[model samples]
Target chain A: MHKHLLLGVEAIGQGAIDGGMSGVYAYPGTPSTEITEYIQENELAIERQLHSKWSANEKTAYETALGMSYAGKRTMACMKHVGLNVAADAFINSAITGVNGGFVLTVADDPSMHSSQNEQDSRYYGQFAMIPVLEPSNQQEAYDMAREGFALSEETGVPVMLRITTRLAHSRAGVEYKPVLDENQLSMPQDPRQFVLLPAIARRRYKSLLDKQASFVKLSEASKYNQYTDAADKSMGIVCCGISYNYLMENYPDEACPYPVLKISQYPLPEKQLKKMEAECDSILVLEEGYPLVEEQLKGYFAGGTPIKGRLDGTLPRDGELNPDLVAKALGKETYVGIQVPSVVANRPPALCQGCGHQDAYEAMNEVLADYGKGRVFSDIGCYTLGALPPYETINSCVDMGASITMAKGAADAGLIPAVAVIGDSTFAHSGITGLLDAVNEKSNITVVISDNESVSMTGGQDSSAYGKIESICEGLGVDPAHIHVIVPLKKNHAELVKLFREELEYEGVSVIIPRRECIQRASRRKRNISRHANH
Target chain B: MKSNIILAGVGGQGILSIAAALGTAALENNLYLKQAETHGMSQRGGAVVSHMRISDKPIASDLIQMGTADLILSVEPMESLRYLPFLSAKGYLVTNTTPFVNIPNYPEYEKVMEEIHKLPRFIAIDADRIAKEAGNARASNMVMLGAASPFIDIDFAKLEDGIREVFARKGEQIVEINLKAIRAGRQFSEENK
Candidate 1:
């Protein structure tokens, strides 16, 4: 038996390859970023020439995967929960169009907003799209489900949704490997018009999809991932889903848990096993990582006969990720309370790295804008977003990836002169270009600053899609060549940068400022790699 | 035997490396291991931690419960105290004496050390100095791991082997420097004891 210590993301990548996946498409986002990165760096994936490059965004990534699936080859698209929202159009439509080959959409949800804007669950998306959802409780199970999910999808002619949360995506454990499978032979759908979702054909496809729901429920009921294990105690039955099952197990060590358990790793509620557990026990306790989907469903419209204890009933906290201590308390076990940290240990929130280009850009912007006052600078997500914190406190808003440019445009149009937008290079490519075009067309008086770090530095220095193309993209967007300014964000250039910002702030037309500099972290990583190569 | 450890430090300080070394050693001993790490936003020079558990039996949660961690191994002095809540009542707290002062209001270095010293069980070492003496200043994380190695249940030889395995791809010279750093750290702890 071959075993290796792998992260959950790495295991998923290996599982996809072992399951004969032809390509894995994704846009870089935390927890989910490593899935494609692992595949990109894998020797087997490179040898097989798998399509594992980062797409422009999640929407393009999913559509590309769907197009590959049309050619009868296994494919996977991965993104974070928020990225699913961006890709929801293609994702929901794919279910209506069905699939000729195996397809999987793996979404990593961030519980408690660990590295995300909000803790929105993706299982709801699966239910919304009417697709089979697979949730894994451990690294080994993540691997197995990723491999088996494809076969299940091909068997049912529908895409599968493999959902995981932050903890499972970022954690590491030992996973045993299975024999690798060969890629599927190229083929086409039996029906020529299967993918053409015209109104008339779509209605018929909708009915067929509705017909598959019963079979999907049956599959969930029969799946090995969802099981009912018996115990002596009948006062309460426990229902643990996904990672919650592991936290539940943590509370019961050395011996088996007294309560019967319905471990639901596959979706559709696994009604048969849940019904059996409910009948055998007086009450039921539900343990889930995110929202109380099971508890809310079991409770129905009103409080029912059997007590359903979970986040809904306040048996467990309603929000945030679950831990063993919380699980123990839910199980009515006494837990040890650790000591508090002394006050001398101050809060060390994440700050801009020393010598970051954003720091210099912010310093110049802050100096120029101090006379005009605050709240005019709108920033987007990236390392530059850290300016909202103490010391800088320059940016007023951080909504989404591309909201900075458009929000600034709206504010400038609304008569807020010198409305400045701050964004990073990767984010600009991700979704900011169209907003820039809007600014130029409307002749909004705003100064847009694109901090060009030549990398997606916030997410561990992934390759930036906008590298070496930011200035050209801005120029193509119809900004005048004279108004476009590029400056190296350095201490020596601070006076020049401030002068350019003042000039742009004075201009009534849209102006673009490019603060170009390589991220210090990325530069150091490159240096190390070059030095290592020299040593070799 | 089970060892529940909380490895703490600021991002980019190589706390993950310490966890990797211990994880490799645990695997060599045929022990089951689970490690939950902090990634994404917090990794931008913020305080980060990893919950590492190794057991002869199957591990349960990736997270260590409050007051249940057997050891808190840290590479930064202030970062060492951040996870005090995870440490057991009698848990060992091993930390580097150096401070990674990034914030403006980083409490006095002397005060931080005082709090660490006040702990019931603790060992504070100047890992940076020792690592520099070991021929590679960058191996301070290895030095911190060596200082905490005594409190861990895994065999010392397995940890040395783990160092070899983790640095194997980086070449033999890098491996030798890290091993020396580990030995120097082990010597300090032994002399203090």
Candidate 2:
């Protein structure tokens, strides 16, 4: 079985380099940025140097993969599901401080917001951090749940996640390779304050993570990737979860499904194959890919019993992502529609790239905010959030990931004196320097800009913990090195970037500007990697 | 015996290197593939596609459902009418009559070639003037994967050993200029379809 193909995030970066992951904290984001860029271009993870770099974001890639699972070994953090909401406070307190070596995390959701903003369902943050979550119905169960999600997070010690989506993290298939283990060494954690939580040791490590949630629901009721099967039309049993079980066997291409499927790629909801397919069929449906986290936990909150369908009883899409002709029109079948997008087809969308220094810093910040009125700019997440479309609608807030300097410092503390914030140069080094040090400790009346472009050009060019350190991180966050300027977002540096955005939008207090350059697709991929290393 | 394709263009139109040489000729035809692709923020230049498939067995939804694409291929020209609802009314678009026109109400090219001549299984070549007469005008997506190699079912020497193993690490004159741009896109789709 020497298959290869890969890409469910490079089969969890080759199942964390053949399962004994030595390191890989992440931050590039898209579909969990190619699982740390396929273990930073693996050649046995760069001859075992491992620790794939690029963090400064998802909470410093989940506290540096929980400090390399607290000095024991095995790692893996990954992101994209709003980079697990900036690594949800050390991912829900690293599940009440558990692990010593094996920690996995992973994430990747983006159900319908293709390149994400929300269709979030990191299995309800893996059941609100109660843990054990896996979810991989394809790419060989995303390479055997990332090669046994670190021995299921070290025989149920904690931190496991895995999740996946955005069509099982940007598809492709095959996979194969398995047996390769060996990396644990440095061992420790035998309770010396297991991981000092400090609230009386996090209430005894949160009741041993609630007494290991009944051994993670009896290892998801004997999971061999949670199956069940049994087909003979017991009305509707189905259930799915994770690549929505490959859009339900792509509507059963002779995998012959009358009913009774279960599937649920490992999760605590396996309660004995979800109570034998909710007592053998007669009406269940489910199919989760993003929300309706197991049909809102089997419709718990009254007015429901077995008649449970998915995306909150709308039978199917109460939102997005899910294909096989929307599961063959929600299984009633009858697909085949096709032709008719033609009125000479139109709407293409995603622009900013004809030599894009964010299109000369959004055409000099839309001609210096055409007399600053229509909601002063805001923007954040990379590719300069396509300058909020149109021939530069000049960003009136593209929202999350360093919400453009604390939403332009809460509209410049409500007074809105020329409120700006543009962002990106690795989202102002992810989370934009704590909203520019809370607008330079309240010298507010903002301007900011920082478009930099040095890299992380929207999840591809990568490297940019705000390159060449955004003018000494805006002069060490205090901002007034003569109101920190810098220019070069060229179309011949658009009149010195419109005189540094009209003298940093008529600075009253905190002003930045920046603009800089580099990402013209990361300067032609660093001139095609320095001419393919000067032709070897 | 299945293909499903889609591919399309725009986002740095390399169409994921024609889906990594049709996923390495569907893994040397041991078959069963999937594909999908379209990384981050609509891949900044946007309007991407991918989908792909291949089969002989075991394949389940890496998308490619709505109307069941049997091949769209694209590389531009209204990104092949935006995946005409995933083709298959006995599909086969192919595309690339040049025209990426990076947005700006870009519609009429004789009304997008009169809506790809109302597709009765289209072709529409140009492919950057046959990959600049096959000398490698960036191997025009391997000349639109060689004008979509006689509508894919694999083996045109396993797509030149899948572009000689995905351009054998950018050497050998870039795999002989992407196998002479997929043989000038399979001799202009065998003398124009």
lDDT leader? 1
Output the TM-score of candidate 2: 0.37
Query: Pick by TM-score: which candidate is best?
Result: 1
Candidate 1 interface RMSD, angstroms, 1 decimal: 0.9
**Residue-level lDDT tens digits of model 1 in A1-536:** 65799899888999999899999989898879999999999999999999898888898899999999999999999999999998999999999999987999999999998788889889989998899999999999999988877898899888999999999998999999898888988999988898999999999998899999999989999999998899999999999999999898998887899999999999988778877877789999999989998888888822567889999879999999999999999999999867799999998888899989999999999999998998999999889999999899999999888899999999988888879999999999988999999989988999999988999888889888877888899889999989999999999999999999999999999899999999999999999999989988
Chain B, per-candidate TM-score = 0.98, 0.35
Candidate 2 residue lDDT tens string, A1-536: 77998888888889887888899888887777877877888898888788898888888888988988988888988888887887798899989997888998888878778776678777787888899888887887788778778877988888899888777778788888878787899878887898889999899899989998998989888888888889888878887877777777888787577787878788888677777777777788887776777777776722355788777767787888777777777888888868868777777778777877778888887887888767777888777777787877888877688888888889879888788888877877888887888889888888888878778877788788767978787788788889887777778778878877888788787888777778788788889899999998
Q: Residue A474 in model 1: shift from native, Å?
A: 1.8
**What's the DockQ for every one of the candidates?**
0.86, 0.31
A213: Cα error in model 2, Å: 3.5
